[model samples]
Structure formats: structure tokens, C-alpha cells
Target: MKFAVIVFPGSNCDIDMFHAIKDELGEDVSYVWHDETSLEGFDAILLPGGFSYGDYLRSGAIARFSPIMKAVEEAAAAGKPILGVCNGFQVLLEAGLLPGAMRRNSKLTFICKQTELEVKQGDTMFTQSYEEGESITIPVAHGDGNYYCDEETLKNLQANNQIVFTYKEDINGSIANIAGITNKKGNVLGMMPHPERAVDELLGSADGLKLFQSIVKHWREQHAITS
Candidate 1:
């Protein structure tokens, strides 16, 4: 399936995302500037991590107003897969495409490291390649990666199996150790970990490759059915 890696002014990881999809995942992929008005032909959308708009008014706050986000919203509404990593996750939350919000790390410091995560719901579209409760290592880098949600929302997330990946330990003090989560419909995923950075064994781990494979696998199945 073809994918579009959204590029904002300050986005620095667009190349990493492109390499992961084009080289590692063997998929058609291209960069879509944030100001672009449409996402017409892409089968999936990827928002890579970076300090969009320089993270001036809070991570992802200003970047949400970009013209391309309207197209992203349309894609999500159509049930197309959308994966947002790191600051991209922040943008999803800011855009209200995903629930919860990010806060400063509990330690008030920028952190960058490989973290162990548990697969919470492997049956979902973005995680089907993983076994339930399996442990995988992915790297994370961010200062405002601490995730929080109100109690009611947290309960809903739990009840709906929207929580997909959780940290094995308190890495950033996110509630329930939430490293990643999907929307209620499971079409959109927002996560703090940098899965694109781990698509190869030479990168220290290939665990993140399964996440991308899961997306393509689901798309192929759905395409076969519809076609």
C-alpha cells in the first residue's frame, strides 16, 4: 500500500519514516508537506516525530492548524490507517483525533533511550503481527511524552481495548505506562515510541518492523475483500 509521510516545517524524522516504508517495508511512500491541501491517493498516513513549529506553544499545538490536517481528519473518518509517532502523537492529541494529552516528563527532562514495551492488544489492525502480552523494545525521545487522561476517558480506553502498547516500567510517568494507543475505531494510532527508527536489526532492534507489517497486512486483507 502507498503511504504519505506528513512533513511539517520543523519535522526532522520524515526521512527516517520514508526509509522505513520505502526501503524496509517495501511500500510506495512519499513526503507530503504540511501545507498541502489534500491526501487523495495515499492508502495510509504517517506523521513522524519532530519539533513541529518548534514546539513553541506546547508540542503539536501549532502544527495542528496546518492545511493538511483537514485531509488527515478525512482519512481517519474513512477508516484509513494513520500512525503518529512521538511529536506526531502530540499532534494527534492536539487535533482531537486521539484522546488524552501530553505533559512534561515527570523528571522535567528530555529523555532519549530504548524502552521495553508490552503488547496490550495484539488483535488490532496496527498490532496483529505481535503476540498479546509480548515484550518488544522501541526507542523513545521526547520531553513532553508523559501521557494523561481523565479517569472516565481512561476507563473507556480500557473498556474498548484502545490501549495498545504500554511501557514495562515507568519510563516517562505516563498514565498506565501508555506508550501507544489507538482510536476507538482502531484506525488511528498515536504513540510516543519511535518505531520507524527500529525497523532494522542494525538499529539495535527490528521489533518495530512488525508494527508496519501489521498495517500493510490489514490493508491487503481489506483490499482483497473490497476488490
Candidate 2:
């Protein structure tokens, strides 16, 4: 499947994401500047991590207004999968595409390190390659990585199996140790960790490869392609 990695001014992980998809996953991928409004032919959308708009107005606050986000919203509405990593997660929240909000790390510091993450639900299109309850380590780098949601939303997330990944060691104090979560429709995922950075063996692990594979497998199944 083809993918578009959205690029915003201050987005630093766009290249990493493109490499993961194009080189590692062997998929058709391209960089889409944040100003372009039409995502007419992409099968999936990826929002990579970075200090978009220099994080000037709180993580993803300003970047949410990018012209391309309109197209992203339209894509999400059409049931195409969207994955947001790190600051991209912040933007999805600000754009109202995902649930919850992020706050300063409990320690109020930018924590950057490899961290353990447990697979909470492997049933979705983005996580099906992982076994249920599998443990994997991925790198995380951010100051506002803590996630919070209302009690009702939390309950719904639990009931719907939308909580996909949880930190095994509470590295950022996210509620329920949430490292990643999916929208109710399972078409959008927002997570704090950098999976793209961990997709290579030289990077210390290839656990993140399964997440991308899951998306491709799901797309092929939905489109009825044998390749």
C-alpha cells in the first residue's frame, strides 16, 4: 500500500518514517508537505514526530491548523488508517482525531530513551502482527508524553479495546501507562513512542516492523490483493 508521511515545518522524523516505509517495508511512500490539501491517492497517512511549528503553542497546537490536516481529517472519516507518533500524536489530539490530551512529563523533563512497551490489543489494523500481551522496546523522546482522558472516555477505551500499548515501567506517567491508543473506529492511532526509529536491527530492535506490517496486511486483505 502507498503511504504519505506528512511534513510540517519542524517535523524532524519525516525522513525516518519515509525510510521505514520505503526501504524497510518496501512500500510506495512519499513526503507530503503540510500545505498540500489533497490526500487523494494514499492508502494510509503517517504523522511523524517533531516540534511542529517549533512547538510554539504547546506541542501540536499550531500545527493542527496546517492546510493538509483538512485532508487528513477527510481521510480518517473515510476509514483509512492514520498513525501518529510522538509529536504527531499531539497533533492528532489537537485535531480531535484521537482521544485524550498530553501533559508535561510527571518529572517535567524531556525523557529520551529506549523504553519497554506492552501490546495491549493486537486486533487492530495497526497492531495485528503483534501477539497479545507481547513486550517490545521502542525509543521515546518528548517532554509532554503523559496522556490523560476523562473517566468515561477511559472506560470506553477499555471496553472497546482501544488502548493498544502501555508502558511497562511508567516512564512518563501516562494514565494506565498508555503508550498508544486507537480511535473508536480503529482507523487512527496516536502514540508517544518512536516506532520508526526502532524498526532496524542496528537500532537495537526490529519490533516496530510488525506494526507497519500489520497495516500492510490489513490493507491487502481489505483491497483483496494477493501480493
Candidate 3:
């Protein structure tokens, strides 16, 4: 599978994402700078975490206007798979690729540690390897990771199975403990945790590899029949 990792100014995790996809998954991966307007020959695009644009205006507010985001939005609209982690998640919300806005952590502190995430919806390609209600440890580091959406929107998201991941414990005061969500079509996913950090047992755990593997496996399955 070919993967593209988007990098904006101040993005620190792009290399980690690159290594996770290329070295760990043994997949073809490339970095797409924020100024680039095209995403050529890539099946999946990832927006890895970090403070984009120095988080000046807001976590992802300014980064949303970057040129590459237009291409990312188009790709996502066309049913291509896209994953956003940390500030990437913030960008998705700012870009309207996903619903809800991130707020300061309930305690107004920067949280950085390995936390457990509960798989709420496993039918999506991102979480298919795990069963619903299963918990997996993934590292989360952010100051504005608390997710908030209006009550009606939250209800709708639940009704549509758009809520994909929730905190296993009430670590952040995210509305409904939501840690991640997907678009209504399930093609775009945005989560706060650092799945790339959990890909290797040497770093900590290998539980996050299932997410990358699941996407590749699904792509292969679809391509096998089409080819």
C-alpha cells in the first residue's frame, strides 16, 4: 500500500509516521509537504501529530488553510482513506473533515502518557482488527485533546456509528469520553492518540500496528477483486 504523510511547518511526528509506515509496515510511503497541492499515487494519507504553524491561532486553525489540505479534503471526499492523529485531528476539525472541536483538557494541562482506548466501532477500516469494547494502550500527548460537540450532533454521531474510539478511562473530559471519530462515510478518521508511537514493542507496545495493517489488508482485499 502506498501511504502519504502530510507535513506542515512545525510538524514533529511526520518522520515517526514515515518510519511507522515504511519501516514497520514495509509499505511505500512518502512525505507531502504542506505547500504541495497534489497527492499523487497514494492510497492512504496520514496527518501526523505536532504543533502546526506553532499552534499560534489555535491547534489546527491556521494549518487548515495550508495548500495540501485542499488535496487532502478532495481525497477524503472521494472515499480515499485518511487518518489524523493529535494535531492532525485538530486540523480535521478545523477543516470540517470531521465533526466536533477540541478544547483544553478538562484540567487545563498538557497530557502526555500511554492511555487505554476503547474500540467503540470496529466495522470501520481503522479499527476492524479489534472487537467493540476492547481496550488498547496508545500514547496521547496534547493540551487540547478534549473533544466537544453539541448534544444533537453527538446523538447523530452515535446514531451513525461515527464515534469510533473512546477513552477507556475518563482521562480527558471529552464529551462522552470520545477519543476519535470518523466521517459519516467512514473514510476519514481523526483521533487524539499517537498510534504511530505504539507500533513497535521496543517503543512500548505493538497494539497500534493493527490499525495500519487493517488499512493495508482492506486495500489489498479491494484491489484483489478489482485487479
Candidate 4:
């Protein structure tokens, strides 16, 4: 699979994400600068976490206006799989590719540690390797990870099985303890955890690899039948 990792100014995790996909997953991956307006032949696009644009204004607020995001938005609309992590998730919300908004953590502090997350829905390409209700530990680092949405939208998300991951212990006080969510079409996924950081046993956790593996499997299945 050909994967494109978007890189914006102040994006610190793009290299980690690139290594995870290229070195760990052994896939074809490339780094695309934020100024690039074309997606070309990439099979998947990843928006890795970090303080984009130095977190100016709001996290991901400035990065959302980058030229590459227009192509990302268009690809997502066309049903291409897109995964956004941490600040990337914030960018998705700002670009209206995902629902809800992120606010300062309820604790008003930057949290950085391994967090337990429950797989709320496993049907997504991002979480199919996890069983529903299964608990997995992944690392999180952020200050504005509190996810918020109106009651009706929240209800709709739950009803449609759009909620993907939820904190097992309310780490950031996200609404409904949601840690991640998917678009109605299931092509776009956004979450505030750093899955790339947990992809290796050397990192003290391998739970995050399942997410990338799931996507690879999904892509293979799609290609196999078509081929």
C-alpha cells in the first residue's frame, strides 16, 4: 500500500508515523509537505500528531488552511481512508471533516502517558483488529484533547455506531469518554492518541500496530477482489 504522511510546519510526529508505516509495517510511504496540493497515487493518507503551526490560535487551526488539506478533504470525500492523530484530529474538526471540537483538558494541564482505551466499535478499518469492549493501552500527549459535541449530535453518533474508541478511565474528560470517532461514511477517522508511539514492544506497547494492520488488511481485501 502506498501511504502519504502529511507534514505541516511544527509537525513533530510525521517522522515517527513515517517510520511506523515504512519501517514497521514495511509499506510504501512518503512524506507530503503541507504546501502540496495533490494526493496523486497514495492509497492512504495519515495526519500525524504534533503542535502544528506551533499550536497558534488553536491546535490545528492554522494547519487546516494549508494547501494539502484541500486535497485531503477531497480524498476523504471520495471514500479514501484517512487517519488523523492528535493535532491531526484537531485539524479534521477544524476542516469540518469530523464532528465536535477539542477544548482544554478538564484538568487544565498537558497529559502525557499511557492510557487505557476501550474499543467501542470495531467495524471500522482502523479498529477491526480490536474486539468490541476490549481494552488496549496507548500513549496520549496533549492539552486540548477534551472532545465536545452537542447532545443531539452525540446521540446520532452513538446511534450510528460512529464512536470508535472511548477512554476506559476518562483520561481527558472527553464527552462520553470518546477517544476517537469516524465520519458517517467511515472513511475518515480522528483520534487524539499517539498510536504510532505504541507500535513496538521496545516502546513498551504493541497495541497501536493493530490499527495500522487493520487498515492494511482492509486495503488488501479491497484490492484482492477487484484484481
Candidate number achieving the greatest lDDT relative to the actual structure: 1
lDDT of 4 at 27: 94
By lDDT rank, best first, the candidates go 1, 2, 4, 3
lDDT of 1 by residue, 129-187 (tens): 99999999999999999999999999999999999999999978899999999999999
- What C-alpha lDDT, on a 0 to 100 scale, does residue 176 get in candidate 4? 95
What residue runs in model 3 are displaced by over 4 Å at the alpha carbon? none
| Candidate 3 total steric clashes | 0
Per-residue lDDT of model 3, residues 174-214, tens digit only = 99999999999999999999999999999888888889998
- Candidate 4 versus truth, CA RMSD in Å, comes to 1.0
Q: Give the TM-score (vs. native) of candidate 2.
A: 0.98
lDDT value for model 3: 0.93
Model 2 ranges off by over 4 Å: 225-227
How do the predictions measure up, each by TM-score? 0.98, 0.98, 0.98, 0.98
Q: Which residue pairs in candidate 4 collide?
A: none
Deviation (Å) of 176 in candidate 4: 0.5
Window of ten residues with lowest summed lDDT in model 1 = 218-227
- What TM value does model 3 have? 0.98
Cα displacement (angstroms), candidate 3, residue 163, comes to 1.0
The top-ranked prediction according to TM-score is 1
